[model samples]
Target: MDLIDTHQHLILRDHLGYAWTDTLPALQGDFTPADYARLSHGKGVIGTVFMETGVDDADYQAEARLIAGLVGKGGMLGQIASCRPELDAGFDDWLAECKILSVAGFRRLLHVVPDEMSQPEGFRRNIRKIGAAGYTYDMVFHARQLGLAEALARACPDQPLVLDHCGNPDVAGQGFDAWYRGMQAMAALPHVWLKFSGITVNCAPGTASVALLQPYADAMLALFGPERMIWGGDWPVVNLGVGLPDWIDMSRALLAGLSADEQALIGHQNARKVYRLPA
Candidate 1:
């Protein structure tokens, strides 16, 4: 089935600054659209949502603008721009700017911030504005922070939220039961959706096979079903584990037993709906 990767990250070291990449030698250089096009070629990928690469705080808008220029090229459908809802000042103006750029949604790296950051009234209030503006909020947090994720979803019931990376499960250590319970709670909320990406990075080295990831994949399928679950490449970060092409192959294998329509839903259909991509 053709795919619309909902969680593709692009790194342009020249136009942006990513201090976080200093520590990770594997992701140090630039990962341009051309690079993605080359890697994803012949992999059934037709479109992509350019997920923010967690640039420095000052570079968020520049990062968005950078991706905006590349949107129509290399199957880049749109972007999930980085945001800071904790600060209310200029939030709406920023949303207006992103709207002009045709951003698909917004994301804040909750895993890197304090747990209490999302609990504040100001944060919740600004997040509501995102929904009010007709944008989805992508939640990227650790597995331990699932409750926090669910609480944020509860606080902003009207906002559409996406749980990234299968809730960033601890597949390497087999932390399944706790993760499942957390995911189940999040799944109970109809407004929340799940992204079937980044699991390979959570697995131990050389152990990211479909056989190992099947249980987690099955649990996600069970929790969110086909309509609510979407696929992602996770790209250079995914390279830390199985790389993009291998992950795509593995994802296809896991979904091989399902009907063609079911595979299409998770692969591209749900993404088009969830991210509101043009048909």
Candidate 2:
């Protein structure tokens, strides 16, 4: 399959000014274009979209400029850049300014923010503005944030929302009921799409098994159906458990019985359409 990685991250932090890169050695350090080339080697990966890492706000433009540099860097096909949705006064202006890039979406990293942030009128208002501008919002939430997901989905009925890592499923605990309820709530909103990726790394370090995630996978396939489903390698991030090839292989294994069109949407179609990448 000709794949487009709709959710990959880059790390080119300089001078410790990038705090998130310095926090964890496993996840930190530089993953230059050369590293991504090797990681994506021989995977039939046609392109990729760079996702934002949760770092200090000072690095937003610095990181964005680096992502902009990726268009000529090869392998990068698109970008889902960063934004502070809660910062409303100038958000519309920021959105107006950001459309110049190859960015297909925006994310605020709800998991790290305070619970009250999403509850305010200004935050919800800015979310509507983001949707109004036709950019997908990568809902990076925890299992417990499903309610927030539901709220956001309802608030921005027209926005195309992609729920990252299946709400980062309770892989370590293999908790399904809570996720099941959360997913059901979000799936009821026609605009939401769920990403099936990053399971192995999210599970307990030594105990991730493909079969263990079946229920979650099955729920996603059943709830969102294939058209609303998209695959992501999570790339170097997935390297925390198995490497990129294994992640792709395991993903294919899980979707083995599905029809070809369904497979295409998960592997290529949905991501391509969502990110609006070049053919």
Best model number under lDDT: 1
Q: What's the C-alpha lDDT at position 264 in model 2?
A: 84
The residue pairs that clash in candidate 2, if any, are none
lDDT against the true structure, each candidate: 0.91, 0.78
What is the TM-score of each predicted model, taking all chains together?
0.98, 0.94
Question: What are the per-residue Cα lDDT tens digits for candidate 2 across 148-203?
Answer: 87887787787788999877778778678888888889888998898887778778
Q: Residue by residue across 171-198, what tens digits does model 1's lDDT show? A: 8888999899999999999999999899
User: For every model in order, what is the number of clashing pairs?
Assistant: 0, 0
Q: Can you tell me which runs of candidate 2 are displaced by over 4 Å?
A: 15-17, 21-23
What is candidate 2's local distance difference test score?
Answer: 0.78
> What's the true lDDT of residue 7 in model 1?
87
